[model samples]
Target: MPAARESLLDAAYAALMRRPWSAVRMVDVAVSAGVSRQTLYNEFGSKDGLARALVRREADGYLAGVERALGSAAGPRDRLTATAEWTAGAARENVLVRAMLTGCWTERLPAPPLAPVPSCTAVPAQRRADGPLPTPRDFVRMVRDRAVTVLAGPGASPADTAELLRTCELVVRLALSCVAAPPGEGGMAELVRAVLPRHLV
Candidate 1:
C-alpha cells in the first residue's frame, strides 16, 4: 500500500512539473501509477489529500537536509550558514520548494476539499488517527523546533539554551525571508553572517 501511494505521488509530482496542479487529472495519475482510479481515491481521498501528502514529504526531505547541514558543519556559525545556504538553494532550484516557502500556489491548481475515508470492517487500521492535518504554519514551526534541537547542544546550560534558541529562530526567519525575496547581492551566506553573533562567526 505504501509503495502504491508513493507511485501515485510520484506521478502527481511529475505531472505538476509539466503543468499547473489544477490541470492534473486523477485518471491520468492512476494510469501513470499503474493503479486503478478506485485505488488512488482510497489512498488519498482527493486531490487536496494527495497534495498535502506530497508537500509533507517534500518538507520532510528539506528538514533532513537541514539536519545533515547541522551535523556536517564544525561550529554553530558554520552550521547555521550551511542550513541557510541549503534553504536558499532549494528554494531557487525547486518549484515546489518555492511554493512552500512563499505560500504562493497561484500557478498551480486550487487545493480541493478532501473526501473522508470509508470504514473498512474487514481490514484493521494500519496507523492511529492523527488529531488534524498540519497547516503550512505548523510545518514551519516543526522546522523551527528541529533547528532549536540541533542548535542547542547536549548538556547546554539553561541560559545558553535560551540564547541558542533565539539565534535559531532568527536564522529561520532570515532563511524564510531570503526564500520569499532573494537578495540581489552578497547572497544568503553573507546575510546569515551579518545577523549572527560575531563571536560565533
Candidate 2:
C-alpha cells in the first residue's frame, strides 16, 4: 500500500479497461506504471494475483460507497433507496468494473454476489507466510449488516430478517446484471426503489 505501489495498481486497472486481462502483459503494466517488471513481480507475485487484487479493490470501493450512502440517510427506506442509487451509479461509472465483467480472466466463474463479510474465513496466524491477507466473506456480511441496520427500527424483529435478505439479494443481483448487460437495461436502482419500500414499510 505504498504510494508507489498504489500508483502501479491504478495503472494496471486503467490498462485492463482498454484490454482484456489476458492481453495486459506485465511489461505493459510495468511501463505504464513507470515501474520495473521485477517490482511488479515483487508487489503482486503474478498476473492472477494482480487481477484478484484489482477486483478486490473495486469491491472495497463499491461497498464503501454503499456504507456512506446508508450513513447519510435518516431512515431505513431512504437508506435502502440511497444504497440502490449508489450501486447503480457506481456500476455505470466504473471502467474497471466493466472490464472485469467483460474480460475472460474470471469468466468461467461468475463473481460471487457482494456480501457483508469476507468470503473466506481468515487463515489462522500459524498458517501465514507473511503476505497480504486473503479477501474475507466480509462483503456478503456487509450487505447483511446494512440490511439489518435499516431494519433495526421501532417494532423491528428477527422475523423481518428474511425479507431484508431477499431485498439485498435482489438489489445486488440487479446491480450485477446492470454492469454486465447493455446500458440502462438493468434498471437496478428503479427495481430496488420499487421493491424495497413495499416490504419495509
Candidate 3:
C-alpha cells in the first residue's frame, strides 16, 4: 500500500481544498485516490487517523522546505533570510501549515488529538502519525536547530554556536508571526537580515 498510501494522502489533500475536512468523505477520497475505501481504512484507521497523518506530513513538508532554504548557496545571513521567507510563504499558502505553526485549528479543519492514540494499525507511517504531532513550540525548535546545524558547521567554538542558536531562534519566532500578520514587500528576509549579526558567514 506504499503507493496507495501516498495517493490517498494526495486525494485527501485535494478533497480538503475543495471543501472543509468535515465535508470530506472517505469514500470520495478513496475514489479520487483510485483505491478502495477499504484500502483507505487499511492505510489510515479512520478519518482522525488520516488527519493525524496529513498533519504529520504537512509538518515534515514544512521542515523539508526549511532544509532546502538552509541548503541554499547564499551566505549565512541570506540563507537565514530564505528560511524565514519560506516559513512565511508556506503558512500563507497552506491552511494546514498555518494551523500547524499557529496551533489555531478552526472548525473547518480536523484538530486531531496531539497525544499518541492507541493505534492497532500495522502501518509504520500511521503509527508514527498516531504519536504526538509537533506543537508550535516544537516547530520553532525544529526549524531553529536545523538552521543552526547547517550554518554553524564544524570548527566553530561552542560559545559562537550558542549565539548562532539564539539568532536562529529569533528568526524562527519572528517568522511564525507571519501566520497572523505577514511582513510587507521583502517578506521576512529584510527583517531577518536586520536582526542577524553582521559578522555571520
Which lDDT values do the candidates have, in the order given? 0.70, 0.60, 0.90
| Tens digit of per-residue lDDT, candidate 1, span 84-193 | 77877787777766666656666574442222334332212211111133444655666667776877768978987677667777777788788768876657668777
lDDT of 1 at 66: 81
**Candidate 3, clashing residue pairs?**
none
Candidate 3: tens digits of C-alpha lDDT, residues 75-130:
99888988888998899999999998998999889899788899899999999999
RMSD (CA, angstroms), candidate 1 = 3.8
User: What TM value does model 1 have?
Assistant: 0.79
Ten contiguous residues minimizing lDDT sum, candidate 1: 122-131
- Give the better candidate number (1 or 3) by TM-score: 3
**What TM-score goes with each of the models?**
0.79, 0.66, 0.95
Segments in model 1 whose C-alpha atoms lie over 4 Å from true places:
110-136, 183-186
- Which residue pairs does candidate 1 place in steric collision? 22-109
Q: What overall lDDT, based on C-alpha atoms, would model 1 receive against the true structure?
A: 0.70
State the lDDT of candidate 2 residue by residue for 1-201, as single tens digits. 566567777888778667766677888888888989988777666665566566666766777887888788776667765666666577668754443333423443223232222323132211121223223334445665676666566676666776777777566555555555623544544566776747553
Provide the lDDT at 89 for model 1. Answer: 75
Error of 3 at 82 (Å): 0.9
